[model samples]
Every structure is written in C-alpha cells, then in structure tokens.
Target: MDRKDISEKYKWDLSFLYKDNQQWERDFERVKSLTNQIKQYKNKLGNDSETLLEVLNLQFTILRNIGNLYCFAKMKKDEDNNNSMYQGLTDRAEMLMTEVDMALSFIVPEILNISKDTMEDYLNLDQFSIYRHYLEQVMKKKPHILSASEESLLARTGEIANGPQNIYTMLNNADIKFPKVIDEEGNEVEITHGRFIPLMESKDRRVRKDTFKGLYDVYSQFKHTIASTLSTEVKKNVFYSRARKYNSSLEAALFQNDIPVKVYENLIETISSNLDPMHKYVSLRKEILGYEELHMYDLYTPIVEGIDLKIDYEEAKDTVVEALKPLGEDYINVVKKAFDSRWIDVYENKGKRSGAYSWGTYDSPPYILLNYHKTLDNMFTIAHEMGHSMHSYLSNKNQPYIYSGYSIFVAEVASTVNETLLTDYLLKNTDDIQIKKYILNHYLEQFRATVYRQTMFAEFEKIIHEKVEQGEPLTADNLSNIYKDLNIKYYGKDIFIDEEISVEWARIPHFYYNFYVYQYATGFSAAIALSQGIINGDKESRDAYIEFLSSGSSDYPINVLKKAGVDMTKKTPIEECVRLFNNSVDEMKNMMLTK
Candidate 1:
C-alpha cells in the first residue's frame, strides 16, 4: 500500500503543474520577489485607472503563483503524508502566502476608498474589463466595510467569534464518547460519530436501534452545554450582522455571494409546500420494512437488500463515460483525457488523503485525488468528482485568471448533476430488477438527504437565528423542541420521532456554520432540474448548461445559475426536483411491491 508500490498511471503526474521541483522552487522565489515588489503600489491604488489596473494585474499574478505553489506542495503531501520534503514545502508555501497576504492587505480596503464614479470610470476602461467584476465586488462591500480601527478591532475578535465552533468540534470529536453497543455480530462496539451511520445501516434491527439511541443519549446528556454553545454562536452571528449593518444574520451570510434573502426564503417556502413526496417516501419505508411503526433509526437500512454491485475501476470509468454522454462529446473526451493522461490519482496508498477533491492551478491540469475503492459509492464518486474537474477545466479554458474560479453556491450543482445523470443512465440501462430497485432507492435517498434533510436543517438555522435576532433566549428545552417539531414535520406520521432525536441538534456541527446548509438544498434542486433537461436531449438546455460550467465567477452566482436552464430565484427548480422525487417513489414502490 506504499505510494512507491502503486503503478505510475494510478498516481497523479504533478509534472503537469511543474516539470520538476526546480521549477516549483523557481516559481516560489518569483512569488517572494513579487510579494516584496507589490508593496510599492500599496498607497497608490487610488492614483489613477492605469495604476489601479496595473496593481490588479500584478496582484492576480502573485496570487496565481502562490495558488500553484500551495496546491502542488499540498497535493504532493496528500499523496503520502509521511513525505517530509513535501511537508516542508507546504509549510514554506503557507508561510509565504501569509506574508503575501500581509503585504497585499491594502489592496481591497484602498480599492473601497476610491470614489464610486472614479471606480466606474476605471471599470469602463478597455484593460479593466477582466478585472471589472473583481473591482465591482470590492465596491459592493463598501457599505459594509468599516473604518480601519473598527475593522482591526473586529478582526481581533475573530478567535472569540470562532470559539463556539471550536468548542463544538472538540466536544464532538474528542470529549464526549458514546456508550458501547451490541453490533450486528453480537460483539460490543463502541459507538462514535464516524461509525454511527454505518452502524445504523446494519441489517440487525437491534444494532440500528442501539446505535441510534446510544449516540443520541450521549448528546442528550450535553444538551444544556451545547445549547449554550449554539446560542452563543447565534449571538456571535447576530452581533456581526448588526455591526456590519445587515438586516439579519441570514442576509449577512448570503451577502458574500451577492445572494438575496429572497433566495433563502424561496428554498424554504418551496420545499415546505412540497413535503408530501418526502412524507410519502417515509411512509413507504414503513411499508417496505413491514414494521408496525418505523422508528427514526430504521431509515438508514436498505429497502431492497441483497443487491450489492461490485464494480471495478475499469467498469466504473466506462459507465461514467456512458452516463455523461448527454453533456456532449467535448465533455466526454475531457473525462477520457483525465483517465488516459495522468490527470487523476485514482487509488488508496499508504498515508494518502482519505477523500476525493478536484484541485489545480489556473495553468495546471484540473487534477483529481481520489482514494477510489471499487464500490458503487466509489463509482458514483468518480462521476461526482469528474463533474467538479470538468467544471474547473472548462472554466479555466474559457475565462481569464481573475474570473476563473466559481462560487461555492454553484459548485455542488456540477457534481450533483453528474450524479443525477449517472443514476438516470444506470436505471435505464439495467434490466435487472434488483439493481433497478437499488438505484431507485439510492435516488430517493439522495433527495431525502441532500434536498429535504438539508432544507430542514436550513429552516432550523433560520428559526434559531431569527429568535436570537428578536432577543429570545435559546434554552436547551426550546432548541430540542424546535428540532423535534421540524423532524416530525419533515418525516411525517409514519415514523416515530424519538425523544432522543430531539437532542440531535446538539451534535450537528453545521449549526455553527451560520446559515450554510441551505446551499446544499438549492444546489441539489438546481442540478436535478438541469440534469433532467439534458437527459431529455434538449440541445439548447444542454448547451446552456455547458456554458454555465464554463462561466466561473464572471457573473453573480445566482445569475450564473439563471444563465443555465434553472432559476434559483423562483420555486420552479425545487418543485421540478420534488416532482422527480415523487415519480421515482412511485416507480420504486411499484418495483418493490412487484418483487
């Protein structure tokens, strides 16, 4: 399992980024020199359009180089964590980046200080077109930008602001431990967050119930303490929002990407109005398991068991290519290039990174690092990451360096679209009823977890933050009650909402993320709608989707999605997604009943 033992093709060829370490060293030195030189423009940003444009150009160059250096060194370290050389390089790169950040701290604040008419005049310049959006974003934050002393004071309070999340992390990861439970084999297994979900999927009902109760029972014991942590977290958000002059914590959180509060409202309102499908899915789970009443713990177990498909790397590649044919030949050929060329590090090796991500510089190939094992989930991971890499590849090909990176708001859309297409292709191609049934169930789970579940989390966050904004206290009992009510509303009457489930919010780390869970639902909803149009072979829709992928941050994230076939500002995408979920439930119900 050592990295040295892996075949050359199975590993990433980082030479695409740099021919050798010497090239990387040369670039590192170049960045250092540029960092030292960039300070010359620190006070001259408001001098004129020419100087401002020049400074912007130089700034991006330094950033691009630093990005390459950090990405390369970190990826090398990821390939083998025990490699000391790359570790040193990564440290050095990180330090240099810090220095560069310090050196360039004046860029944005000074840009904001410029008069709006002057900034507009600069944006109208021919050479400033590429940096137009970048400058506009700076101007957009002008109202929120504070005085230097005030900003410094707020910056100093960052650690205090982050205390809640840090405390929650230590508690969840290190402090609290779940009691030992009897696993499926009658062996005593200590329950932990890492093993909770897989244990809940155990075929033995006793194991599922024990793990579920065991995990939540520990959370229940810490309910009051965690409620305080979450309350303080909410208070911290409210403080920052009020300090920054935003109307609410939710608005402040969404404002970074220029997302309006209406988008958040649309997500909650649309999904709430369309909960019948989610309820039906839950009801069908009770019927499928033949249970008098399905407990919350029973949800993770496979509805159609005995259909574990073992796919190899080769088969997964072929299947991914076939599934993605709807996107166009160009996209397919690039994925093929990723496979044939060394654009992917495809397997697990000793000390390699655990999960998969697509990373590269603007100049480097859109490289993927995957710890791929040949399970169905792993196959889907390939398609999912391929979606991200392709998005990067297309954007890097199409846009300038300044505008080449897209927002997190639309990032999940590409990956999930790939997943949706793959699921559709598999269902259509497979005649085996068992495999068909499994895929259908998998589709239903995707909607349940990504769309419905995340929307519920988003709604909870909104409610808690709203209460804090309105000066209401968040007691342990009230928090638990709010969570339990939402659980009942989301899962419906067929499943029992256990008392222990009320404390579930005590353990969720996302609650401290300040309104971050809603993007998952919105992005998933948009992907389903876009993927459905592409699957129907609508040429205009397919091309627009491709164009959306190629568009990085050239426009606002919402406008970027709007340019694509789906509009997140309206309720259409979420409704379209729920419709698909309903049809899939019907198909899956018929399949499960017939067999």
Candidate 2:
C-alpha cells in the first residue's frame, strides 16, 4: 500500500513540530541571528559565575532552537526525499548548524581556561546547578581543548568532514540499483536495501543466492569508489585523534562519551574467546537445514519452517504496548499515547527514506519513522524504536536540555531492552511449539546479529583505523582482505567464506561511523542484564532502569549503566550474553530433536 493511502490517524503529525514551513523558516532565521549573539560572550565565560551561567543559558537556547529547526527540515526531507523544497531546507538548516557550531566553539576552550578551583565554585553556584554536569563534561576535555582559533578551525571543517558519509549515502541509497530476482513464489522481485533481508530469509535457496549475489554485484561494481569513501572517513577520524592528542581513533571516539577504551577491548577479547556458541549455532543450522555446508546466504533462512508469524501494523502496536507493560503503568500510558497520537510515520511512501529511526529534539514530541511490513521482525523494530522514543520522552521531561540527549553508547540499551522484553513476553505467552521455536530463533538471531556480528564489525573497524594510524594506505584489496580474514575467524571453519563476502565491508555504512558499532555489542549485553532484572519485577531494578533512562548525559555512559546495576567495565555482561546464547542454542537443539 502507498503511504498516501494510509489513514491520517496512522501517519505522524509533523505539524506538531512546526505549524507550517513558514514557522520552520522563522525558527531557522532566529537560530541564525542567535549564532551572532554567541560571539558576545566569546572571551567572557570565566568573568564570573553569573557570566558563565548566562553564556551557558544562551548557548543552550541557541542549540535548542537549531535542534528544532534541523529536526523539522530533516524530517520533512525524509518524508519524501524527492521533495526539492524540503531538501533545500534541510541543506540550509545543516549549513546554519555548522555555523552555530563554529560560533560556539570558543565556549568550551574558554570554560577550560578557568582554574579548576574557580570552575568548581561556579558549578556550586545555585544559578549553575542545572548545568553542573554539562560544565564538568567540558572540564573533562580540558586536556584536549585547543586554542580558540584552532577550535574554530576544527568546527569549520565539520561540513567537509561529513563529505565521505554524504557521498556513501547518496551512492548507496539514491544512485545504486539492484537487479530483479525470482522469489520462492516464482514472482520476480526487485532487490533493495530494505528487501534484501527478507529475500535472504526466503525458504528457496535459489532466491537467497540470487538476491545476495545481485545485491553484492552492484556493490562490487563500485568497490573502489566505496573503498575510497571509507578510507577518507578513516583518515578523518585519524586526523581528529591526532589533533585531540588521543592514542588512536578508537580512543578519541570513545572519549566523547567518556567510555573507557577497555570496554571496546573487552568486547573483542570476550567475543573472540566465546566463538564456540557461534560455531555451535552454525552447526545447528547446518544439521537442521540438512545442508552439508552453510553459506553466508543461508545464515538468515529459518531453520523451522511452516510457522507464519507475520503481524500487521495494528497488531504490532498492541503487541509492543502489551510487551512493555512490565515497565509499569506510566510507561504503558506513554506507549498508548504514541499509538493514539500521531507520534509515528507508520508506512512507506514513494521516495521516503528506508529503515527506521526514533528522532526528535527536546522541544518536539519524540517521533519514529518505519517502513513497517507486517512481519514479526517489523514488530520487534516497532518495540525497539519505541524504546528510544520513550527514553527521549522521559529524559526530556526529567532533565534540562543540556542533559536531555543521551550518548550513543547508552542509546542502544533502551531499544534492545524493549526487544528483549518483547521476546520474553512472546515466549512465555505462547503455548504452540512452532511459535516457541520461531520466537527462540528470533532471540538467537538477535544475539548473532547484535553481539557476534557487531563485534566482528568493531574488530574490522579497529584494524582499519590502526592500519591508517600506522600510515598504511587503504586500497580496496587491503580493506577486503582484512574483512575476509575477520569473517573466517568469527564464523569459524564450519561455514564457507564466500569471496563475495570480502567486499561486504564496502556496503556497510557503519564503517564510516567512527568506532560506533562496538556500542551495539556492549549495549546489547547490558540490555540482556537490565531486561532480566526488569522482568523479575524487582521494584529496585525497575526504578533503576527508569532512572538510567532519565539520566541521559548527566553522567558518563559506563557510570550510568553501573548505576542501573550493569557494570560495563567488567566482563560479566558479555559473559552473561554468551551464556544466554548458549542456553538458547541448547534449548533449540532439544526442541528440534524431540520434533
């Protein structure tokens, strides 16, 4: 069905953000003017506590306004990417944002210029209470904060630094096209990034192989181009790491959220050691599917067939709300509000962007976009994105703007917790053996995708960045060879490592995301621990999880998870995830044997 055919009740009301484009224009201009005002306090941040507080307040106001402006334009453009007017608005908003960033670049250096004793005094002032955490975060960067001139220069390079990612997005989403392949039903279907997964899950091996090859065929055509773009992105990360005096790009990336480097290292060390569960799952797949060998294309096909668990959008909404009831009455109420109110764009339209994301500013309602296909996976996606929306809603309500936005390190925890809860609810409530098997497979796949797969990506990221740091050139062959070796190690000798999988790195947009994929592995592990606690109905655990959601950037991400009773610094969480994966595999093996 076309998006326009969807009811107004199902579509998100972006009008809630701005009554019209005119209002958005007004906000854009106001933000532009406010950027000029930021210069007024350029050198006066440490004049006194009052001056510091005022500057902080002004900076927050300007940023908050820009957030709303950018959110509106970007959301509109995402609604229909073909709309040139909205696209232009998004471009202008992005440019204005870079300008605002450059204008406020001095604020950090100026704050760092103050003596620690005086900074503490200012933080203790009643007027500065709200910004205490924010100020302390600035102080943490004291060692890395450069002179104002250099800071401004770095900020100005922001747009240019985004060039690689922008190019990849255009090439992947807008420019590239996949060929048509015959599906299991003998119908010819065109492949897309959206349809690629579903196609891989096809019962017909012919379909899966065709879609996989067809998809990669296009990616292979431009491997060199994509390789160059990824290389540039890595080089950009290397540049900032050196400039900030960090030991490596990984350290610099993790430092932004104050995440310890050991967290990344621990995830790799632990997952690499725990590849037994992964190998076992692979063997189980090979045994159940009656395949002598498993290929990359065979990884996604269901082991137990004949169980159709497709869910429509309405059912998905109800399932999510019901599954999240363990969160408490107030949380359920907000989920209900999201369903009833126009807080989500519920269907795909022509030119609408692919995939799903929860996005909004402090000033606007938390919004979600989904090209929801009435499948079990899409149901989990609804639950996942709503987790993010609710986290934002609670944080924005509980804290001021400065502390409202959570770091990406902790962001995945909330979403994964929701998914975990949904899985548990499905398994407990269903009596049918087939249904149980399907849900169990889903849970196992989540671990494989989030923990094992992402860790592999993290290791790949680490290797590439280290190579670049050591002044090695990143050619297509060099990148592909490194990725192919990691694939062999992670998946083990049980499965065939197709040569086509070598260029798979060329297609993952996350390679350009700068040490970001590791968080998925860590966050998934943390969510497993948190979800287990929440499901136990322990008020203390529930309250702590809620508090973690509300905490946002008020504390370091590692410390925040620790407060929620999950010590990410320790190896316990990843070990717990590994144990869970093993347990699930055992259960699946038993179920299949009995059947």
Candidate 3:
C-alpha cells in the first residue's frame, strides 16, 4: 500500500521535527553559514577558556542543526524511498554534513596542543565546567593523536582499510549462489542468505540438512578467498592498533567508548568457566527431540509447537503498556503519549523501510519507524523500540546535546530490559500452558543466541586478532580448525560437530565488525539482571535504572551501568543470566515431561 493510504493516526507526526520542508531548508542554509563561521576558530582554541568555550558552543549549534536537517530528510525518504525529492534532500543534507565535518577538523588537534594540566585548568573555570568530560575526552586522545601529517596519511588509507569488508560484502551478498534442494512439500527451494535461517528452522530434517550443506558448499568452494578476506580484516585491525599505540586490537576497539579490556576478557573467562548450563540445555534438547544425534542444522527447529498469537496493533499497544507497568507510571504516561501523539510510524507502506527502529534528534520527539505486521514478534518489537525511544527521550530531556547520545554498549540494555520485562509479564499473567511453554522456549533461545552464541563469536575474534598481532597468518585450514574447535568446545558432546560447519565462520558478517559482538552477550546479561531487580527488587533499583537511562554519554558506559547496578567488568550479571536460562530449561523440561 502507498503511504497516502495509511491513516493519519497510524503515521508519526514529523511536524515535531519541522512543520514543512521549507523550514528544514532554512536550517540547512544556517548550518552551511555556521560551518564557515566555526572554521574561523581553527587555530584559536588555545587562546583562552572562553574562546574555546565559544567555538565549542558554536560547533554544537551547527551540529544540532545538521542533525535535525539530516534526520528529517532521511525520515522523509524512509516514508517512501521512491520519492526523488526527499532522496535529493537526504543527499544534500549528507554532503552538507561532510563539508561541515571537514570545516571543524581543527578543533581536536588544537585542543590536544594544550597540556592536560592546562586543559584541566580550563575545565575548572566555572563557565567551562559543563565541558569537563568533553575536554577530558579530547585530552585522553593525546597519546594516540599523531602529527597532522601522519594523521592525514592514516586518514587517506580509509578506503584501503575498508577493502577487506568491501570484498567480503560483494562475495557474500552479490556473487555467491546456492544450489536447489527438495524442501518439505517436495518443492525445489534454492537457498539464499535471506531464506537460509527460515529453511534451517523448517521441520523437515532433509530440507534443513540440504539447505545447510548447500550454503556451506559455496563457502567451501571459496574458502581460500573467505579465509584471505577475514585474514586481511584481522591484519588491518592489528595495523591500526599498532599505529594508534594501543596494546592490542581488542583494546583499541573497546577504548573508543572508554570500555576497559578487562570487560571483554572477563566476559570470555566467566563464560568459559561456566559452560555447564549451555551443555545442560543442549542435553535437554537432545532428550526432548528423542534424537540420538543432534546435528547443527537441527538446533533451530522448534522443540514444541507454538500458538499462533496473532495480535492486532491496537491490542499490542495495550499489552506493551500493561507489560511495562513495572517501570512506574511516569514511564507509562510517556509511552501513552507516544501512542496518542503519534510518535510512531505504524504499518508498512510501499517503499517504506523494512524492520523497525526508534530514531530522532535531540530537538525532536523520538520517532519510531515500523513496518508493523500482526505477530507476537511485532508486539515485542514495539516494546523493544519503545525502550530505545524512552532512553533517547529521557536522555535528551535531561542532558546537553553533546552528552545526550549514548554509547552502543549501553544502548542494547534498555531495549533488552524492556523485552525481558515483557517476557516476565507474559509468563506471570498467562494461564494457558501452551503460551507458557512457547514463552519459555523463546526466552531460553534468547539467552542461548544472545549470550552463549555471541560469546563464542567474540572468542573467535579474540583468537584471530591475537594470531595476527603475533605475526601469524590465518590459513584456510587453521582458521577452519580454530572455528571447528570452538564449536566442539561450545556445543559439547551431545551434538555432532559437523565437518561442514567448520566454514560457518566465513558466513558471519559480524566478524568484520571488529570485536563488536561481545556487547550482545554483555548487554543481554546486564538487562536480565536489571529487569529481575526492577521487578523483584525494591524502589531504589527502579530509580537507579531510570537514572542510567537519563545519564547517556555524561559518563562512561560502564560507570553509567554501575549506577544501573550491573558491572560488566565483573562476573555476577553473566552468572545470573545463565542461572535464569538454566532454570528456564528446567521449567520447559518439566512442562514437556508432564505433558
């Protein structure tokens, strides 16, 4: 359906961003003018604290306007991607942003020239106090900041740095093709990247087996290329880490958000020491399925049939609001405003973006984009995206623009907390056995996929980067061997570690994302612990979590999370999440056994 056919109530009010495109164009010109004006302070940041503060405030103003213009245009295009006018607007906004960024490039280096002591002195000035953390961040980069010529050289290598991921993307998404296999109903199904997961979840063992082998077969044929591609990516990370004077690639990646290396190391070590829960879950799955040997492909198929919980959008909204009551009334009131005030763009339209996300700028209401379909998952998406929107809304409400946005580390926690709370509410309120079983199944898999699986991926990354850092090359054989060993260790003896699954590492795009997968495990564990505390703990716990939501980038993500009551640098939250998973497995086991 076209966007015009969607009801006004179903659509988001972009007027909060701008009443019309002409208003956006006006800001667009203002940013262009501000961009030039800020460039005049290029070498003057060291003049005085007030001068530095003036330039900084002007920089933020230009940034604020650019953000609003860019988001408004992009959201307009998202309303209908086929609309050329909005597309052109998006392009212009993007180019204007790039030009502004180029113009503001001198601020950091000039700040770095001032000694840390001097920077601290400037920060201590009453008028410059709000920028203490911001200046500290600039001063923190001093050791890593190279000479301008060296920095320019490194910046020029940007495309070269991207070569590995670019090649992998082309091969994985464009060139690779899979052979056809006979599916469940005796129809030929050709597997592509999109259909691979759904086919793996098919009830027919033959289809699942063939689908798995067919995709990996393509990867196997290009194993050398994939191995080389992954190797180059790993090597690139090592090169940049060394140039930046970081001790390791992992440390370098985490350092960008001020995350300590111990956080990553602690997650892997804690998870490694506690594989009993995972092994128990695997063993339970084998027993429940009555299969003597559980293959890798069989893991995704449902252990029990689920009720087709087709909920309408209106009903989903009420359910989400009801489920979120544990968070307090004020939170629920904002959610109600989201619904009544049209903060959400609901339903699919022709050329609308697929999937859902909560997005907007510091100045605008948090806008959500949804291609809503009536499903249990869609309802959960509402809860999840609302979690993000609320985080942004509260942060924007409480903090300055510079500190309003958050690190990706804490970003997933708010969303996952909402999901976990929704799950808790459903489990408690439901009287139907099937509904209970289905939710338990879903929750168990969420833990398995998010924490366990992603931890294994993170370990793979740590191993590979360490190898490259140690001057070792990753060959197809050793790379596959390393991945296969991880699978064996992670899955335990109850499951057959497929030989073909060795190349599964090549299929994951997240490997190219550079030590980024660990956040999934850490965030999931943190959310589980926080959600439990909020629902089962006292008022202090709820207040702390809300404060964490409002804190945003005002502090380091770890420090902010400490306020929320989970410390990623420790093992407690992960252990708690695993405990929940183990208990859930037992619950599902008892239900199946009694039935």
Question: What TM-score goes with each of the models?
Answer: 0.85, 0.98, 0.85
- Write candidate 1's Cα lDDT for 114-192 as tens digits: 8889888878888888887787788888888776456646655764676797677556654676899988778987775
Please identify model 3 stretches exceeding 4 Å from their true place: 1-32, 69-101, 152-236, 312-314, 339-356, 369-378, 472-481, 499-509
Q: Which of candidates 1 and 2 reaches a greater TM-score?
A: 2
* lDDT tens readout by residue for model 3, 1-595: 7789989999999999999988987888888888889878877888888889899899899988999998999888878766889878977887786677667767777888887788778877898878888887877878887764566466556646767876786577546778998889899877765456657767788899999999898999999999999999999899999998999999899988999898888889988888888898889888988898999998877676656566899999999999999889999999999999999999877666556789999999999988786766678889989999999999999999999998888888888999998998999998998888877877787888889999999999999999998888899999999999998898899999999999999898889988889998999998988887788957888998999999979998989998887888888888888888888888888998884
Which candidate number would show the highest TM-score if scored against the true structure?
2
Query: What number of clashing residue pairs does each candidate have, in the order they appear?
Result: 0, 0, 0
Please give the CA lDDT of all the candidate structures: 0.86, 0.90, 0.85
Better of 2 and 3 by lDDT: 2
Ranking the candidates on lDDT from highest down gives 2, 1, 3
Ranking by TM-score: 2, 3, 1
Give, for candidate 2, the lowest lDDT window spanning 10 residues.
1-10
For every candidate, C-alpha RMSD to the true structure in Å: 4.1, 1.3, 4.0
Candidate 3 overall lDDT versus native: 0.85
* Top-lDDT structure, candidate number: 2
In candidate 1, position 427 carries an lDDT of 91
